[model samples]
Target: MEFIYSHNLTVDGREILLHIWDVPNSQEQAEDGSSEEKRIQWADSFVLVYSICDRASFNILPLKIQFIKAAKEGQSQEKVPIVIVGNKRDLHHQRVVSSEEGRLLALSLDCGFYEVSAAEAYHGALMVFHGLAKLIPDTKLALKKGTGIRGIVKTMSAVFARKRTDSL
Candidate 1:
């Protein structure tokens, strides 16, 4: 699998990091067991993305739920929000996963679910992150003091700059 694209977007002065994964097959394996764990650790919220065209991928929903449950169990009292995303809505004719199923699953898991088509530049993914950010208790305090969004961006930029400077 490869990362097709990534973008950093700011909404209401808050930063959001977006990444798109390009997997050749429905099955994804992490060469290093730590990579998946590391990603879960870094993410305070997760969006389980799936293509509506892939029927096989839909079968993995149980596994995805298990992973999320495990992650939540291992985390502190604060549970991370998990959003289920069904992409490729434009290909309705080829859709294998119906919106009802998605909704039912989300309802059962007590999470949010959305069906979108990125081909039209749908903002569903961004909305998911925005919602998660709002749900975080520290978001308002950080935004109010101007230490949350700006601080994170500044720190990230400085870290990358230092890495580049060191490599020179």
Candidate 2:
């Protein structure tokens, strides 16, 4: 198993980590195991992204749900937000999971749900993280203190700009 792509984004003062794994169709280990459990333990939140174009990916839904349940079970500190992301929203005609079904499943699992298009470098993923970050108590306090959203964005922008300038 290898991660095909990954991105790190900061939202409302919390680090949002996104990872996309590429696993062979023959791999049974990808479905469930101890390693998956370890990954869930490490993450503050989990967002499972499934491709609407592929029905095989839909089979992973049961595994995703199990991971969320395991996360909730193992959580001793606080509730970690779990989100089911249905990618390929641009292909509405090919949608496998309807918004209504997504909402219902999310409600049942007490998590969040969204349908987005990662093909366009989905900004919705960042927005979802931002929304979840807002729910963090420390993040909320920081925002209230005026040392929050604006400050973080400015600092991040400046840091990235400096990096780009140095590279140039």
Candidate 3:
């Protein structure tokens, strides 16, 4: 089964909805009509993950990264940010992917790198989400700063525009 976790985050007075979906391993089938390859290209940002204890899992990441770049061809690569995370640090004794290897990969991609264990490192887990949040621009603040009732109307317009496009 496909696993999805949804959470609403209030950061800097703005409410951001984050949809965290785990990409299922099977490439042959999907519950929905669309393929995972098709859905991935539509994402605004990516949090590509791998288990530090599983070297094979870590090895596949390069192919995934390459696919993301190729899928986003012609668009400014910077616009589509990525955050590489090495999880299962709780089992560091069994870790197969070195911290240096993860850092080097992140540097190569020009994206942020974070090592956190969801089971143990509480602060580090939050930092990963916070780090990803920093990548997204706060567009609402710009709209909310305008003077008078006109500002409210402009903000409403923006909200509706976003909703309309989202429904499609």
Candidate 4:
């Protein structure tokens, strides 16, 4: 099953509205516009979650991250805010993927990491969303600055370029 949630928060003294898409890992697509490609396009940021108790789920994280990265090939990978989450933290006794492993993977991928249990405590889940929410605005601000710098460079280049003769 898939779930969607809306969150309202203030970041940098400005109100932001976020639509969180809790897309479950599945090969099947329903009639709705929930296909992987469409979902990837719809997302401004991503929180990819895997079950800590399931090794198979842990194994798929790299592939899933790569898919999102590829789908956003036009943007620099670092600009995309992706959080790696290992869910079912309360199932530590049954865990096949260690917190250390999850942490290392997130470090290597340059992503924020969290281990939370949706079935256990709501605080952990809230922290994950809030952390990512903060990151989204920072990423957007950086992109805007980069674009602004490029625009300035383009304008300067046009000014310095040889002028065309106005002969009709």
Q: lDDT of each structure?
A: 0.63, 0.59, 0.68, 0.73
- Model 1 bad stretches (over 4 Å): 1-27, 30-32, 139-168
Task: Give the Cα error of residue 52 in candidate 3, in Å.
Answer: 1.0
lDDT of 1 by residue, 1-168 (tens): 544344565666766554433343333454444545544544456677778898766667767667766876576766567777788999999988898888888788777788888787747666766665565556533443433444444444453343322221
Better of 2 and 3 by TM-score: 3
State, as a TM-score between 0 and 1, how close model 3 is to the true structure.
0.70
lDDT per residue for candidate 4 within 1-168, as digits (tens), equals 766565666656655566565666664234343357666765678888899999888888888788778877566655678999999999889999999999999998878999999998788988987788778856454443333333433433354453534332
Would you give me the overall lDDT of model 4? 0.73
What tens-digit string does per-residue lDDT give for candidate 2 at 1-168? 544344565765555444334444345354566545554443445566667766667567766677657665665656666777778888988776677766776677777787788777758867766665554446423343433444443443453343322221
For this target, which candidate reaches the highest TM-score against the unseen true structure?
4
lDDT of 3 by residue, 62-127 (tens): 777787776764565455568899999889899999999999998987778999898885788678
Ranking by TM-score: 4, 3, 1, 2
- Could you give me the TM-score of model 4 versus the true structure? 0.73
**Model 3's lDDT to the true fold?**
0.68
Q: Where's the lowest-lDDT run of ten residues in candidate 1?
A: 159-168
Number of colliding residue pairs in model 2: 0
